[model samples]
Target: MVTATADFVVPDELLAHEPPEARGVPRDAVRMLVSTPSAQRHQLFRDLPTVLRPGDLLVVNTSATLPAAVPTLDGHVIHFSTCRADGTWLVEPRLAGRAGAPTVGPLDTAVAGQRFALRGGGSVTLLSPYSQGRLWVAALSFDDVPGYLSRHGSPIRYSYVPRSWPLSAYQTVFATEPGSAEMPSAGRPFTDRIVTRLVSAGVQVAPIVLHTGVASAEGHERPYPEWFSVPASTARAVASAQRVIAVGTTVVRALETTGGAAGSGWTDLVVTPERGVRVVDGLLTGFHEPHASHLDLLAAVAGPGLVSTSYAAALAAGYRWHEFGDVNLLLSEHDVREV
Candidate 1:
């Protein structure tokens, strides 16, 4: 595992608290910081058609966000993270009132075998610690999980966002398959119009499925295995494209897991400078928090020198951060040596 060391403090004011739509900004109009080893340029996300070459393939994740936060009767929120192959779930329990409060961590008192009644009719019994003591393997008593969430769950939110938003706000234009605990937010800035423009400009777009689990923002933990699938068509595109630009780190994980070949299954692959990227040529992703594991993936694709330079430029230019914030497009430079 590669440890990220992109140390830099983000001013609290730069954290986007709501979607661009709420701020009267069109999704495709959000600012994008385009960076390469040699230079950086500020542009709008809608200018993607001009940034990418005609034969370049843009890989996007189509995993839809789930309203994964379900409130319990005793005032706790259960964030259903991932469904194990055995039909159980990995969950994180947070005290309801304090859950969304900034800088507060999830409840750590949940012991194995403890049960909590859901607001509806079912109960979740904590089975064991899933990872790092932050998430638990839970046995859910409810059936038709999707229906239950549609009725009782809201989008999993944090304190940075002051109000609840509709699930639509958490989805991207490419979203179709529903399973991700949180949005693969890097794709959130895309719009149908922008996609049309990309196609008109001859840039190719392909879809992959990678259902992301709950984020490890607070803990900065390494990502766990998540389900992903690369279709035969996309794999063929990747093999032939002049460049392969992954729309999000999720796509990078999926494509790299299969080494550009078509396949599907759980992947624990973590792209780092040591394991450098093999198929992806560039990355179009949202600005991540300081020291995020996502930064390691960026370094793997573009090298640490370019990643650091790009982030410094973004911060100096007051670019926003987080899922709802602005984006960064990091292109590989053949002349720049990886650190």
Candidate 2:
């Protein structure tokens, strides 16, 4: 039987606990590890413009990170994952044990019909179970969720993060729409200066929207359906570009779900080795956890052999992991050679 790349072991020490800004570095100062079929190259994230050619079109996700974690009076936190068409949301309730402790774990409480009083004025009523466990379909009492979150919610964080960060620290420079439960972190290394340099080098940057859901996953679980949109202009640029470089796995999913055409919908597409990619030529993403389903998408684009080598190289170099971590650029063998 073939093994999945998701079974790899990532060292806990490599998990980045703070943003670069906290470490006294600029947004684009993170390390970038470029991977190809034949070789790997270590470079700074600021070197992106010099690395790619003029005709390469970079596709980015514009969905902003939401301050989706609402604390309750009882010490439990409610995470707003995704908002459904009916105005209700899919949420997960977690017990925040204490400071410097795990914030989310197995939730054993029954939520149906239970009303949670948030720190803010409004309340959340649990409607029903959205899945097997941990998640529920719930309604918000407030009329405007965005405005409420701005005033009361904090960025969703786990134990690894140790402390909370402002929502502005979670947002990318390209973020324009507010929806993602987590940051589109691949774009975290980008800055206005970096973008200007890329444009000066003739690299075209385009936006696609993929309102990402929660990042926490059950062991070996496949990706859940998330809303995505590929506009006509982005589709055209992707079709005409010499190379279509996706900024994250979200971009890969959105572009591939439409088969490079213009469309919008919820997609449960899993880009595995068996179900190889069709549109994206390369990917720029952060280092993910070992055994993460995201690794399957990387394998589908760069092949499992190269993915393994790249992971090994990244670990050997003590590269950081998580949303505020280092980045990986997966391009073709020829593209790497050209750089």
Superposed model 1: Cα runs more than 4 Å off: 1-5, 98-104, 218-220, 334-339
Clash count (model 2, backbone only): 1
Question: What would the per-residue lDDT of candidate 1 be over residues 264-285, giving only the tens digit for each residue?
Answer: 9989998888999999999999
What are the lDDT figures for the candidates, one per model? Answer: 0.87, 0.85
The digit string of per-residue lDDT tens for model 2 on 138-216 reads 8888868878888988898887888878889899999999989999999999999999999999999999999998885
TM-score of 1: 0.94
Model 2 RMSD in Å is: 2.0
Query: How many clashes (backbone N, Cα, C below 3 Å) per candidate?
Result: 0, 1
